[model samples]
Target: MVKEGLLDILKGNFLVSDEASKNWRFLLFASVLAALMIASSHQADKKVHHIADLTQQVKTLKSTQVKHKREIQQLLLESRLKEELAPIGLGVPEQPPAKIQIVSQP
Candidate 1:
């Protein structure tokens, strides 16, 4: 009996035999599992690519921020401020500022 079953499988007879109906549910289940596995793999690949893109964007933003910070530092320098204000007729005071004191009556 076992030899006949093996021969039936090798001859592709089992696929057309009446017993093949019993295997249809299991075959459908396996097919669905394979489809889900393929979909999961594709989703993981997309997430990896998205993360790489986000990482590159973060690096670009960081470099741009550093450049802007350097420009702001240069603009904040006293020499640079004086040079910019000089063109507008503004000059530094030569004498020190004075303060007045008032006495309160008791």
Candidate 2:
């Protein structure tokens, strides 16, 4: 049965026959749709993997940003600066700073 069907397909008998021609067209359409579905699935998988990679990179960048932010916050602390400056004998001034005004000659 299968061999006869293959022989009929090879001899183009299906194209000339009314019932077989409809089946042939339907099979061809189905095959094309299957191919497109496979291609679309592959493309979707590629995009999913790309999005996963980007998500991981975003997480890494966020962690790095957080670490830098924490470091900056620690560095900006007055107690931390005071401790760091103790060796140099630098301390906050007790007096308010004076403003200096310069007069330009005309």
Candidate 3:
């Protein structure tokens, strides 16, 4: 009888009409598998949402950076132009840029 029961379990033939109280092992196994599938699906969906949100934020920051960089460059050009026109007293000369000279010692 015990060998037959063991073989039944090994064969995994837990039919729904089984009125046997000892048939809960198959139910528990199925329940755990179902729960695992649900949790993994939810986790994957969350990761996808997070990635999309991060991508949008990165795009926004990149556009903001580009705008600020363009404004800074325009300001620098205007200042240099004013300096060049300062000889006729339209503006004061701007300070010179820092220099790096590579000197060779023989």
Candidate 3: misplaced stretches above 4 Å? 1-22, 78-106
Give stretches of model 2 more than 4 Å off.
1-19, 83-90, 98-106
Kindly report which residue stretches of model 1 are placed more than 4 angstroms away from their true locations once superposed: 1-11, 100-105
lDDT of 2 by residue, 1-106 (tens): 9999899989988777868768788989999999999999999999999999999999999999999999999999999999999899998889989999999999
Clashes of each: 0, 0, 0
Report every candidate's CA lDDT: 0.91, 0.95, 0.83
Write the residue-wise lDDT of candidate 1 on 35-62 in tens digits: 9999999999999999999999999999
TM-score of each: 0.81, 0.64, 0.58
Residue 13, model 2, lDDT:
88
Record all residue pairs in model 3 with backbone atoms less than 3 Å apart, i.e. clashing: none
The 10-residue segment of model 2 with minimum total lDDT is: 14-23
Arranged by lDDT, best first: 2, 1, 3
* Tens-digit per-residue lDDT, 1-106, candidate 3: 9998788767766544366445677678889999999999999999999999999999999999999999888768977778767787886537877799999999
What value does the lDDT take at residue 88 in candidate 1?
90
Q: In angstroms, give how far residue 67 of model 1 lies from its true place.
A: 0.4
Best by lDDT: 2
